[model samples]
Target: MRIDSHHHFIDYSEAEYPWIDDNHAAIRRSFFPEELKSVLDTHNMDGSVVVQARESLQETKWLIQLADQNDWIKGVVGWVDLCADDIEQQLQELVQLSPKFKGVRHVLQGESDDRFMLREDFRRGISKLAPLGLTYDILIFEKHLPYAIELVKQFPTTAFVIDHIAKPVIKEQSFAKWNEDIRKIAEYPNVCCKVSGMVTEAHWGQWKAADFAPYLEAVYAAFGADRLMFGSDWPVCTLSGTYSEVYQLVDTFIAQLPAEDQSKIMGETCVKFYGL
Candidate 1:
């Protein structure tokens, strides 16, 4: 199956999603599974993993409900208060809701503290995951990679996938620092990388496919096809271009690999990583 491992479904309610502001006006409205079905069909994708955009357990529950209703939504990477005192109980309740509730993610990108993932409480929470057969999605900027490397090292068995290749600064054509940090993180066998969200990071309107080549080449070399997967980032990707445009960019890049390796990057690796 061809799976887009990292995309989101948003039902825009101000009370439920206070995070949406005028700044993100481009995607301020709701984005449901129906809206995405056509795009997925057009791209010849079989299914997708709907990732959490909000940090609320309510949002997680909502995503699980969506997954329960839609067969095409193969899995969900939802949010939980990993550091909550009753986190174990919370996870138990979530898992009971649906088998498609596959993994957990926190928006580490918005965090001000660069070393937030290394905090004892957070690490303790992450330590709780492996026993439950859940994976963690690492979402952060290039600056937070060092801490991510440390965080992943502490939990050698817990599966982790770096979202948007850690959101590198492709717009400015900057890569030296991100390239070095990503290479270092890729050294950890437990970690994987997503080739998604590149268009939004580049000069949104003016970016050509060529603008992403160097960054894509760097990640492909560092993670290899086995550890890499494709993610559309969907509604957010629409900020720069259509879902087809983003999908085509990655499809073109991965097409260079042999067919077996291409299949892994497109879907198999994601299935193995998230246990979908």
Candidate 2:
């Protein structure tokens, strides 16, 4: 079954999503599964993994509810306060509601401290995830790549996927450092990467598919098809291009691979990673 490994369903509310600054007008409204399914259906995508857009247990439960209601939603990568002392209990509470709860993520890119993941309380939370059969999604920007490498190295047995390919600074043509860092992290078999969110990092409306070539080539070289997965980063993708446009760039880029390799990057790898 084909899957868009990462995307978010947002019930837009100003208070809940203060991060929706003026530049992000397109995604300020709600984006639900019914509408997403309509788009995915046209692409012959069988299902998707709904990721956390907001960090709230209530939102996590709500996402699980959405998954339970929609058979087309294959899994969920929701958020939990990994730093909280009762994190395991909180995960159990969500699991009690449904096994659709597949993994956890922190907007690690949003954290000011580069090594925030190594903090005592946060490490305590991360230690609880894999033991419960859950994966962790490393969400960060270029500066956090080293910390992410450090984070994944220590958790070698836990399954992890770097979100947005570490949100590389494509706008500035930032490459050499990111290229080297991505290759270093991929040295660990426990880590995979989502080839999503590149458009917004580019020159937005003016981005050409060719602009992604070098960056995509770097990641594909680092992770290869077996450890890479496709993610639309949707609604947010609307900031630069339509869902079709975003999906097309990645789909077209990976089209060069062998059919079996393409199959793993498009869907199968995620199924095995999250055990969906």
Candidate 3:
């Protein structure tokens, strides 16, 4: 099965999603499973792992509800207050709701603290995931790479996938530091990387497929096909280009690998990582 491992479904309401203000007019409206299903079908994708766009247990529950209704949605990477006093209880409650709840993620990219992932409370929360058979999605920018490396090291048995290949700065065509950090993080066998959200990081209007080649090459070199998975980033990706365009970017790159290696990056790796 071909899996879009890291996309989101946003049923936008100002009260529910204050983050989608005038700044993001393109995706200010709702984007539900039905909408994504069309795109997936057009691309001949088998299913997707719907990730959380907002950080709330309410929204996470909402996603579980969506997954419950949509057979095409293979899994969900929802959010919970990992630092909450009753975090283990909260996660247990969520897991009980649906077997599709495959993992957890926080918008670590939006936080000001570079070392936020290493906080004792957060680490304690992450420590609870392995026992529940849930994975953790590391969502952060390039600057947080070192902290992510340290965070992953602390939980050697827990599965962690890096969202958006750490979101390299492709618009400016910068990669030296990001590449180095990615290579370091890929050293850990427990961690994996997603080839998603590249278009948004590039010069949105002017980005060509070639602009992503170097970054893709770097990640492919570091993670290899076995530890890499494909993601479209969907509605956010539409800010720069269509879902097909985003899919094509990664699809074209992975096509270079042997067929078996291509199969792993496209879906098998995600299935194993999230137990989907």
Candidate 4:
């Protein structure tokens, strides 16, 4: 099946997306599965993995409900308080709700670099998830790459999907340290790269398909087709481009590769990584 491994949903009545607020007028409204399915239908995408945007159990439950209602939603990578004392209990509660709950994520991109990944409690919390057969979706900017590298190394048994390809800003075209860090993370067999969330990193309003090529090339080189996956980052992606536009970019970018490799990056790898 063709899977958009990374996509988002928003229910303004349910909870607040603090980062978005009124600042992101373009995507301030609700983005439901019905609308998303319309885009998927257009692109011939069979399904998607709805990822978490806020750190709320209620939101996680909401995603599960969405998944249960929509056959086209293949899986859900929701959120829970990784540092909470009852984290294991919380995950147990989540699992009872739906088999589609494939993994968990933290909005680590919003935290300060030094303490985000290496803290004692956080490490303890992450270590707990692996035993539960859960994958962790890592969301961070360039500065957090080292922590990501370290976290994946320390928990070699855990499955990790590095979100947004470490949020590379192709418009700025800044490579320096990010290039080295991504390569290091890719060295771990347990880690996978999700080609999502970059459109907003570019000039936002002026980004073109070509703008993301170098960053894309670097990630493809590091992870190869086997460990790479595609994600739409929908609703959030609207900040830079429409779902069709982002999907088309992925379609065009990998057009020349062997069809089998393209199949891996576009869907097969995600199915394996997220257990969808």
lDDT digits (tens) for residues 1-276 of candidate 4: 789999999986524776786657888778889999998898888999999988889899999999999999999999998888988898888888898999999988887655577887788889887888889999988888888888898999999999999987678898868999999899999999999888888887698788888888898999999999999999898888888888888888889789998999989999998788
| Best of the two (1, 4) by TM-score | 1
Each prediction's RMSD to truth: 1.0, 0.8, 0.9, 1.3
Off by over 4 Å in 3: none
Regions more than 4 Å wrong, model 1: none
Error of 4 at 155 (Å): 0.6
Q: What is the TM-score of each candidate against the true structure?
A: 0.98, 0.98, 0.98, 0.97
CA lDDT, every prediction? 0.91, 0.90, 0.91, 0.88
Cα-lDDT of candidate 4: 0.88
Write the residue-wise lDDT of candidate 2 on 112-161 in tens digits. Answer: 88889889899888888888899999998988889888888788788889
1 or 2, greater by lDDT: 1
Candidate 2's C-alpha runs over 4 A off are none
Model 3 lowest lDDT segment of ten: 16-25
Separately for all candidates shown, the number of backbone clashes (residues 3 or more apart, or on different chains) is: 0, 0, 0, 0
How far off is model 1, as Cα RMSD?
Answer: 1.0
